[model samples]
Target: MKEFNALVVDPVGLHARPATVAVNAASKFKSEIKLSYKGRSVNMKSIMGVMSLGIPTQSEITISAEGEDAEAAVQTIEEVLKTQKVIA
Candidate 1:
């Protein structure tokens, strides 16, 4: 598994918009993507799962992936999070 910590850069936090972006990006890969904040973890490919985390702005979260494409999935997601200004 590969993991990285990202800080929510969006003012609105991990709400529907950025969470949808993450789900869309994560669904394209075969890896199992997990996002964790505080003490809870959720499937990154599920919009509801992500938004339910209630991640607020400036909060830190960890994104991890496991499976054949774990590296690609983690890297792409990290980049997407930064590029999309959802996380930094």
Candidate 2:
């Protein structure tokens, strides 16, 4: 497993459009991806699961992935976040 920390930078947080982008990218990966906040972890591919975390701007979260493509998946997802300016 690989782990990394990031801060949610989107002014709107992880709701609506941002949430959709996160879940869609997560679903495309074969790795077991998880997004964690305040000790709670959720499956990255589940839109509702991610939204339920109520991630707000400036909130720090941990992302982890395990499986064959874990490293690549994490890197790609991290890039997506940066590209979308969702998290920093």
Candidate 3:
């Protein structure tokens, strides 16, 4: 498993637009991606799970992935977050 902490940088947080981008990026990985905040863990592929966290701008989030492509998954997701300007 690989883990990284990222802070939400998007002005609107993980609402509809960014959530869609996140989920799409997450879907490409074979690894099991998990996002956690405030002691709660949510499935990365589930939009509702992500939005339920209410990750506001500047809030820190932990992203972890496990499986064959865990490293790649983590890297890709990290890039996506950066590209979307979703993480700080």
Candidate 4:
């Protein structure tokens, strides 16, 4: 598995827009990607799963992927999160 932690910087936290962006990004990968916040973890490709976390600003989130494209998946998600200003 490949993973990285990021601090959410968005004032609204991981809301619909950014969550959709993340889900869209994760869906492009074949690997199993997950986003973790607090003690909960959910599939990164699932919009409902991601939004259920209710992640807030300054919260630390861990994104992980397992399978052939694990590294690439994590990297892509990191880039997406950064570009969306969801994490810095």
In order of appearance, the predictions have TM-scores of: 0.94, 0.92, 0.92, 0.98
Better of 1 and 3 by TM-score: 1
Give the per-residue Cα lDDT of candidate 1 at 29: 96
Could you tell me which 10 consecutive residues in candidate 1 have the lowest summed lDDT?
Answer: 13-22
Q: Model 4, stretches more than 4 Å misplaced?
A: none
**Residue 26 miss distance in model 4 (angstroms):** 0.3
Model 3, range 10-79, lDDT digits (tens) per residue? 8887677877888888888889999998899999989999988988887889999999998988898888
* Runs off by more than 4 Å, candidate 1: none
* Clash pairs (backbone) in predicted model 1: none
Pairs that collide in candidate 3 are none
Model 2 stretches with alpha carbons more than 4 Å out: none
Which 10 residues in a row give candidate 4 its minimum summed lDDT?
Answer: 13-22
> How far in Å is the alpha carbon of 15 misplaced in model 1?
1.8
Candidate 2 structure quality by residue, lDDT tens digits, 6-52: 98888987677867787898889899999999999999989889989
Give model 4 RMSD, 1 decimal.
0.5
Question: What's the candidate order when arranged by decreasing lDDT?
Answer: 4, 1, 2, 3
